[model samples]
Each structure stands twice: as C-alpha cells, then as structure tokens.
Target: MDRRGHGVARHRDLSRTHYRNGVALSHETGSHETGSHETGSHDTSPQALTSVLAASAAGARAFARTTSEERSGMLHAIAAALDAHAEELVPLARAETHLPEPRLQGELKRTSFQARLIGDRLRQGLLADVRIDHADPGWPMGPRPDIRRTAVPLGPVLVFAAGNFPFAFSVAGGDSVSALAAGCPVVVKAHPGHPRLSRRTAEVVAAALREAGAPEGVFALIEGVASGVAAVQDPRVRAVAFTGSLRGGRHLFDLACARDEPIPFYGELGSTNPVVITPSAWRSRAEEVARGLAASFTLGSGQFCTKPGIVLVPDASALIAALPPVHSGPMLTPGLTDGFRKSLDELSGTPGVEVALVGEPLEEGVPAPVVLRTTAATVLAAPRVLELECFGPSTLLVEYAREDEVYEVVGALRGQLTATVQAGPDDDELALALVPLLAEHAGRVLWNDWPTGVTVSDAQQHGGPYPASTAPATTSVGTAAVARFLRPVAFQNLPDAALPAELRDGASGPRLVDGHLKTPS
Candidate 1:
C-alpha cells in the first residue's frame, strides 16, 4: 500500500517499520506505550536493539566505501523529500509541538537547507579536509616521509533528538544528516515531545535514502528511554550526538564513557547566554536595547539553547522603564512547563533578587515573560544562584555600578553557546576587554546583537565548553558538524594505487601540498 494520504494507510505506515530496533521487525511484535500523543508503537526490545546496532555497524563499512558523489546525492535526495512533504510535516509538527505555523514552516525550511548546504560542500571536497606532505630529501626537521591524511567515518552513531525545534533538531536534524554525510550510519533516538512527528519524519528519511541507493541501515529511528540507554552502552555504536538539558546530557555522557570501549559523546546540553551592555551603549539606545532583549528572551518561549538568560546593564531604573512588557504562550511540553515554573520560583525566592517586570501570573502550562533585578555584587557573591539557567521567557537583570563589575559577571559565567556585548563607538575599551573574556566561556561571541538566531554556515560554532557541549572544538551546526563523526588517518609512503583518490597524485580536491593550500580543477 502507498504510504501517502491521511487514512488507514497513514496509520499502517506508522507501524510498518520494525527497525524501531535498526532493522525492520515482524508485524507481530508487541506494542509499547509511546506517549500520550502517540499510541500503538512497540518499544524497541533489547534483542531488537542489538540487531539494529549490528546492522548499523555493518552499514557503516558499506557506506564508507561509497564515493563522495554518492553521499552527496543521498543528501540532495533527503532534502528534496523533506520539501515535498512539508504540507504534511508542518501541520503534524505544529499539532505535536504547539509551535506556530510560520515557525514550523521556517524551521522545516532551515532543516532542509542544512542538508543541501552539506551536499554542496561535500562535492566541493570541503568536508574531507585532505592534506598531503611529499617526501623531501632535505627538510627543516629532517627528511619528511610522504604522508597523505584524510578523514574517515567512525562507524555507527547514535543521535538524541532535541525537544524545542522538532524539525531542525529531531529525526532528520543536523546531527543525523551530518553523520550520514561523513559516511557513518545513524540511529536517532526520538524525542518524546514529538513522537508522532518523529515517526512520520523518519518514514520520509528512510524512503529517501532507499530511493537514493544508500546502503540499508544508513538511518533508523528508535523509541523509548531503554533503547537510548542500551544503544549508548552497546559496543557496536562508535559515537553519540545529543541535544538537551544538562542533567539528561550529563547522565548519558557518563553512560557512554562507562562503556567497555568508551566512545566519543558529543552533547549540546545547556547554556545561559549572557548579554552585556556597556554604560555608553545603554545611554545611547536604551529603548532599542530593551526591545531587542524582550524579543530575544521570549523567542520560542525562551526555550532556545542560546537564549540570553542573563543581561547586565548600568542603570536598572532607566533600562527597566524603557523595556516593553512581553507575554509568552504555552511551552512545548508539560514537563518543560513544570521545570520552568520550578526554576522561576527558586530565582524569585532568592534574597537579593527583586521583580522588575511580571506581566501575568503563570497558569498551569502557560508561561509569561518575567524580568528580575539584582546587584552585580549579589551575583558575584552567589554565582551558584544568580548565574544559572531558567529555561523560560525570563531574564535576570544584573545592575552593574561600574565597567569593572561587567567583567566580573562575565568571568563567572559557565560554558555558553553564545555571549553578546552591546556597545557603542565610545565604549571601545569595554568592548575590547569583554570580547576576549567572553571568548573564553562561549563558543560564539557577538557584538551589539542578540544570540537568538543562529545562522547555518561553515563558520558557525554551535557547541561550547563543558555544559554547552561535550566537544568544544567541534560544532553541532553548519558544515563543520560532520567533523564530529570523522577521524583523521594518515597513509605513509603508500603507492598511488593504494592511496585514496583524494590523496593520490594529480588528485582533485582542496588540500595542502608541501604546506601550501591547493584547490584542484
């Protein structure tokens, strides 16, 4: 039966795939309770999970043998498939996530664009990062043997989908796509927030890969917390990619590490992106800064990993008055709502914290924008309390008496996805001082801008130190994200026939020969 329309066929498509373990299971497998939104799904049993991981391990070797052109074609196919199903996917996502139609549509576009962008780069040989050093009789350090180096796949990877941006971070999101581009088979652990959406999206992806002639087991989607944990501990799984809270990510990170053969666990956990306003900048454009802050902190109900959780300004009295009131809608999940309320209550009860703007009391699931104020000294004294994340449409305003206090507050911040500085021409000294300090704690540093909208490009860095992400040197966005699944290997003194095509003599790719960058025709 064709898996296209809204009817019994759709429902069958949902249950047809037994690979919920990695490979398809028989139709007789017992059903497992998925969630309130999604029912009649089988929780991947331990036996099935092992079979799935083994298939992915086998698929990884077959996928690695595929030429870059073949991989690029697979990516293009996935992107086109996503675009074709937008009408069906966008509504399903909105229903499950409660996100507005425009937001869901835009996110779907961004997700597909990421796939195509990586495809374009792969064909250009940019993703491989090839390098060659020819043998030299006389060299600076001594005779250097002929060495050819290129990145290769790290086998199977397990990805944990994020909750907030279902399309951009779930199922066929950046992590899954990037790993596939690097020739590694991927198994995405679906997020509970949008299980139905996850299942449907996985159907589209699996079909696209099959049509594109990708090897079997190149991609799969598994449900249930047990499946995720078991996948992490499985020896066949080589690496893990995750996006979620600090507690959850940390727990998984530990599990991945405890494996007999520990694998690399790349987790984008939590971030309290802080924005600094120099005295001169605040005086010059208080209202403009205030408006930007209000919109940014409330974007996506402040659930973005890069949301500015804390903002430091010179005068609370002037800035507070200029700030416009903001109201946020319901969050994505009931669990998220409960966590938001708990975090807000803790901050509100803190002795030094005072309410600056409280639009409306939060109802059971609906969240309202809130702004709290406290002195820089209080934050400095109790960094544990003031400098934590409150994942909602709220920001803690830390009033600094002098420019020196701004430095102290930034210095005390945890690893962050982003750090912003609002400055004017007259505040050059302060901006220069803060930029370097912010760089130490954040993956991406911004100047006179908010950190809400992250661009998908080669230069973009979406991961930071420790709490922001497990792997700081790598990124979870942009073309570079593929690097997380690729490990470098050097071939020394290999004959032309034995060397990989990109490293062979007269090869075509972007590479360095004798320490000089070269791009072939």
Candidate 2:
C-alpha cells in the first residue's frame, strides 16, 4: 500500500509484525488492539474494530466520571509526555512528512501547549454551561419548577488525523484534546501521509494517560481509510471529527449521517478564505497589501485551510506588480501535490483568467508559486468555473470597478472560515458596510490583517458554514471546541442527590441562578 494507507491491502493481515522504517501499521490484536493477529491474516476486521470501539465505549463512561481536577491532570500529563518525547518524535515526523525540523519542532511545541491550555480552561469550568432556576410561583412566564441544566460528554469520538499538520492536527491535536477535556474517550484514525508519526504519537499519549490513572481505553489509534469509514458507521462511535479536503470530509460526513444512529460529524474542510482590498487601502499601501497577500497565500506552500485563495481589488495590475516573488516549495504529500497541480491547471485554463506571475521553475514533485488575475465580471459570469480553490502556492486576483460589484461578489461566496478587509481611514464607510456582509458569509472577519494564523483562545472561531466546516455552529479550535463533544441535559424537579455536582444548590463555578449570573464563593 502507499504510505497514506490507501489502495494497498498486502499489509492488512500483518496485525502482529513489528513495524520498521516508518511503514504503514494496521490495527492489530495486542494492547490497545495494536498487536498482530495470530493467523496473521486479520485486516482491521469488523471484530477487531468492535473490540476497540467497545473498549472506548466503556472508557467513555469511566472518563465521564472523572473529576475536573483529574481530567486536568491527565491533559497536563499528555502535554508533558509529548514534550518529553519531542526529540524522538520530531525526527520521525520529519522523515514521514518531509517538513523541516524547525517547523516540526514548533508544531510539536504548539500541540503540547494546546493540550495544557485546554486543561487549564477545563478547570476554569468553561466546558460546563450550567443553569439553575429555583421554584418561582410569581415568575413572569409561569410557575417555574426547580430546574437545572449542564453539558455532558457525548461518548467515544473518532478523530481523523490530518495529513498536512502531522503534529498540530494529528493524533493528540485540538480535536482529541478538546474531546478528552470534555470527558469523552477518543479513537484517532491515523492518516496515511504520516503513519509512523501517528503510531509513535499515539504510544506517547496512551502511556501518558495510563500514568495519569486515566481509563485504559480513553485513547487509541487505528489506521486505513476503510477502518475510518467503518468506525464512523460503528454505533459505539458517538461522534466524528476531521480536517481535510472537501471531497473526503463530505464522504465521511455522509457516512456518519447514514448510520443507524446518526451522530454529529465535525469536519473542518478547506476554505478559499476570500480577501478584499478597498480602493482607498489599495491606493495608500498598495505594496504592503501586495506583499502580505503573497506571503499569506503561499504560507506552508499554500496548504493551509485558511489560505486566501481569492483577493478582490479595484485594480489588479499594481498589486500584481508590487507583490514579492516566492520560490518553489515542497508540499506535505504526493497526493496533495497532484491535487494542487490539477486545480492550478483548471484555474489557469479558464477562458478569462490571465496569468500574472509564475515563480522560479523547480524540478518535478516541487511546485512553484502562481498568481492569476481576472475581472470581476468574468468571475460573476462564471462563478462555478472561476471561484474554485487551487490548493497550492497560488492565488487569484479579481478586479472590481464599483463598490456594488464588491457586494455582489461577496454575496456570490459560500461560507468561509475567514474573510479579510484591507481598508484605509478614508474608506471607513466602505469597511463599515462590508463588515456585516462579510460576517454573514464567513465565521471570522479580519481588518487590515491576514487569516493564515489561527489563534487558540476563548474567542477564537475556527469554523464556518457549509464547505468551511460540517458543523458551522461549532469550532474545532479554542476552549469552546470542547462544547462540540458535549450535549446539554436538563433535570426538572430531580432531587439534589440525583443532580450532578455542578447543578446542585450552593455548588461552585460560574452558573446562572434564577436568571442571574453567579460565581462560586
């Protein structure tokens, strides 16, 4: 099979063989179901997957019973373990991903930091949205009975590790961190692009959770696309999370919905991340905007989900001329490079599209940066043909003559992860008019800034409507991410003894009591 664990079935039965040289490893029969089967012919059989999912189902209950303090310790332990093994893990990651050592190191550090940050936020009572109402006969609505509500963990979550970000978006990344913080068990499906790193990373995480006294099945890792598809359909898998191309995400999402008991599928699919440059802003700092646009779109060889695929400007010629040149760069995987090439070809071949600049030629397998320019009328005329995403070190510049065309173009856009506005002081009215319109189509709107770097914070919103994400009302980053794996349960007239600690009278943390906000004393 190819490194990405796809289109190859020869290794499926080697459930017990020791892996070497970072090759593909199947879900096996040993501890965590990671051992090879005795017959040596077992692929990720339905029976093996059932055992893994069954264990996770049991772990979900045990993890849910853990105190916030205990869960916090578990997350911290995971962070420490990742940091401690950075030396060993980074090299393996580099070998599998072809990413630089420094970039991998930083991404590993960020992954560990995200774990601890989620732990800190969990202890702060951010995951639990608690509300209580005492009996009030004179209530405006009606006679209100005693009621309490708080979020509860769903169950076992299946996380599909991302290929591009092997460290930050892989095994122990935000999706797993947030779900575990919310008291759910996690089973990560390894990405084929970096299977060796995925295996080692899972070993580290599993050991950390064990040492921290977490449930045995609190975390596990499996391989292969068939395994992932089966896991999504498994009843024991409560929810699913993913980060990848729209085609893959949509396929898995459809499977999740088609299950007997349909569950929530949180998929952060790629976005075009449109950017607009007002006439005044372009006139004032045309060079600056040009440089920033080039850098943002080409960052990480333009694999980022938030890469600015389309930029709207009044005149494309000046921005195109002022933009700095970029060199050819390596993409994460061969599949990705192929997709990038095909997308670029389709976009460049469009009838009205014009090539603005092409970067230095590089040998095969390495892609050069490209910039394409076309008119707003052309884009409006052929929205389906022109507005498609080209997922490499490339971008499209669409020139508009009137402000109304800006609105029309923005309206033509589907949901986006982010949309940016570069407006000068002289364009205050235009920026003001554009903010709400952009907000309607995007999850986050930026002013005079780029959208490539996503901040991990309480206010961070990393998801958008439709193709930007499977669940637009939720985020796959920040503290609020934990909320996705939790569902609210309200108890009406239940005895205090039957209530969760957070819902009891005189309980601690921030909560709403009789419609008034109260902090723990």
Candidate 3:
C-alpha cells in the first residue's frame, strides 16, 4: 500500500549478528549489529558500551555549550532526518506494535513535528528566561541584586522509552529531544516491544548528530532491563524521563531517589483519566457526552495514558445508549492483547459490575473493546474498582445520583494526569465547582474537551500528582519538559571572565554568568 506517495512496506527481517557474549541482535540499516537482551540486562563487551556512552556524553557537553542558534539548527536536522526515514520506521513500528499503518504514520509526523517545534522554541530562547531586576527604593536595605532565571543542562539523562508510542516516545522522541535541547546528553533504554525500530531511529539520530557536528556522548541507545537499572543508577546520569506502568516508573523513581546524590525522575505513569458529567449536563446533552466519551475511550484502542478509563455520570442509561458498538481491533502487541483479555475477565466476574458492551473474543492476538457499568455508590464504596487502569479499549461508567456524591468521588480520586468535565452552557455552577477540584486532583484540568490528544505546545501540561506522575509540576510533552533535567545554581560574586560563556556579556549577546544574567564585552 502507498500512503501519500510513500510506499508502505512491511518490516523485512535482517540477519542476526552474534556478539562475543553469544547474545544475538539485528541491524536495521546495515550488516553491522550489536547484542542486548530484552530483560534490560546483557553480557555485552564493555568496550562497545563504553564507546557508545562516551559518544553520547560528548554530544551532550557539546550541546550544553552550544548557542541557542546551534541547538535550533541541530533540531532542524533531526526533523529532516526523521522525515527521510519515516517509510522504514513506520512499517517496522507497525509490525512490532500491531498498530495500523495509518496510526503509525500519523505518529511519525507528530514526532517529527514535535522536534521541529522544539527547535522553534529553542531559536526563540524559550529556556533562557532572561529577567533583569533593578534596585528599588522600597527595599528595606541596599539595592537588590539583579535576578534572572534560565534553564541549564542537568547533564546526562536516562530516558525509558514507552511501549505504546515507540516512535513518539522512543529513542529520538520528545523526551530525548527536550533533554538534548536543554543541553543534556541522553541514554535511551529502548522499549522491548520495538527494539529494532528503536535501533533504527537511534541510527537516524546519530547520523543527524554527525552531520550537524554534535559532540559525542550526546546520545546512546541501550537495550535490556538490567542496563536500564544500571543506567539510572549511574552517577553520570543526572536525570530521568520515563513513560510506562506505575510499577515500572515508581521503581525507577525510587532508585533515583535512593542514589547517593539523588536526581529527579520525571515519569508519566498510567492514568485512569476520569471525566465527570454533571446531572444537568447529562440531561441537556447526554447523546453528545456519550459519543465524545466513546471516541476518547477507544482512540488508539484505549492505549493512551490520557484515555478516559472511568466516566462519572448521573444517568447510566443515557451513557449506555450513547456508546458505540464494541468492535475487536488489533492491540499494540500480542502480550498487551492477552493482558487486556485477562483483565476484562477478572473485572467482569466482579460482584457489582456488569458488562455494558461485550464482543466475542477474537484469535489469541486480537483485543475486543468492552465497556463496563456500575452504580456510583457501588464504585465509591469500592474504590478499588476505580484504581485499575484498563489499558485497552474499555471504559467503566459510574452512575452518580447527586452533585455532592460526584464531588465526593472526584475528591477521592488519586493523582491523575488529566480530569475532564463535560458540561453544557446551563451547567455553570457544576462546572465552576468542579474546575478547582479537578485541578487539585490532576496535573491538568479540561473543560468540554477530551484529554487523549496532547499538544506539544508551551501551555500543554502532561504530568500529574502521584499515580499520574511521580512529579506533578513537571511535564513530559512540552517545552517545560526540559526543566526535568535542569537545576539552578546561585552565584554570589565572580569575575566576568570566570563566568560561563552563556553568562558572559559580549557583543554576541547577553549571557549567563556565575548563575546571574549579564552582558559581557
């Protein structure tokens, strides 16, 4: 099949190349190959690993010292490279993920566009929030020192790739881009489900770096769960970016926190992104609410972290009547499909819940979308029902009878990435009351919009408290994502020549010096 004049091809198996350790790995672009295990551990030669790490570190330091213009140029190069390699990557991603071609293609574009957007932001010096504070007469003592704030590299970063959006979240995706732009070297722990695709993307990025004259150690790609653990624990690694299950993200978070010199771990863990529909809103636009919820729940087969897992509505019948028919679709992978089936069976057998929509099971690798329904009182009483993130095309509707109960249930929600409210024009009171409450419960709150589509813009917030993310104030999908890898240092008094180039004043422009903003001659 051809998509937009680009020939869509299936993934072709490359010959396996064995390493000295007897572990076998495949090369996506050339005959040269390396070995790494899927379980995050490997017995590979230390020389190969060292070389990769050194190159990545060099790239990182070079990026750190680079002018905003240089960094922006490198990002543009990355975008062009990704566009050039889309054909090969999309097909490999599809074969590895079992996702449709169109979805993969869309993701490819999103990923490339995100890189370009970051480049644009870099050129604008978004991270360099240069502020000048002058002496004020209102000061109690002497003149106040000028204070300015700008982001700096957090050093080497370790990115744990997510399984669902391999291209967008993998080796050269948002996490890596943000970190690189912030002057941090990146070491990516490739997702096991799409290691080959990750390797290919990594190569593309490496080529871009070489062509752009990026320093070594700017980027490295490693596979295996053990290697991931080691990378996070490595003292050289200063920060972490991860998107995955709560269990996995928390483990890395704990590991980072327990380090001798602890570092920040910004993880976008799983979320049961909830949507609350007030009684009045439901009465006014029950059908509209239902259709919107249906689309949000099933998009990407409910694989998105922002997928609405639970709907709080007053009328169960209205929600049921509005839902679309359940249909089976290929999940991201066979293992995920099986896992969803087991979860569905377990939830169906629960005492208070009833299956609202169910379809016949498909072959072992296919997942059928399902919708389960239960009363608000029952769900509130048994909060465990709301805790589970059914990571497939499934949603549970919890019917509440009163506004107070809806508020009570929402208040009890664990930290969430996003909480959405669907209210009509007439439901002003409910909407007003719910906004602050939802904001407190999640990192981002939405009004009359689904949370599944995350924009890579400055205003976008992609992290939440606790379960939604380990760090609520940090985001994984916007310009702010770079902050996860940066730390600020204050400079009391230092000579202008001693200051870093970014802090120094020159005809070139204003620079940061000894942690303060200054212009050097």
The lDDT per prediction is 0.82, 0.82, 0.73
What does candidate 1's lDDT look like per residue over 84-189, in tens digits? 9999999999888778999999999999999999999998899988989999979889998999999899999999888788999889899999999999999988
Most accurate candidate by TM-score: 1
Q: Cα RMSDs of all predictions?
A: 5.4, 4.5, 6.7
Evaluated against the true structure, the overall lDDT of model 3 is 0.73
Model 3 agreement with the true structure over 416-517: per-residue lDDT tens digits: 999998887854698878999999988889988899998888888998888888888888988877777777754334455765554444423455443475
User: Model 3: what TM-score?
Assistant: 0.86
Off by over 4 Å in 3: 1-51, 58-60, 134-139, 143-149, 360-365, 501-521
* lDDT at position 55, candidate 2: 77
Q: Given candidate 1, what's the lDDT at residue 127?
A: 93
Better of 1 and 3 by TM-score: 1
Which pairs in model 2 have colliding backbones? 4-192, 15-36, 16-36, 29-35, 30-35
Which residue pairs show collisions in model 1?
A: 18-25, 19-23, 19-24
Error of 2 at 20 (Å): 14
Candidate 1 ranges with C-alpha deviation above 4 Å: 1-36, 39-42, 360-365
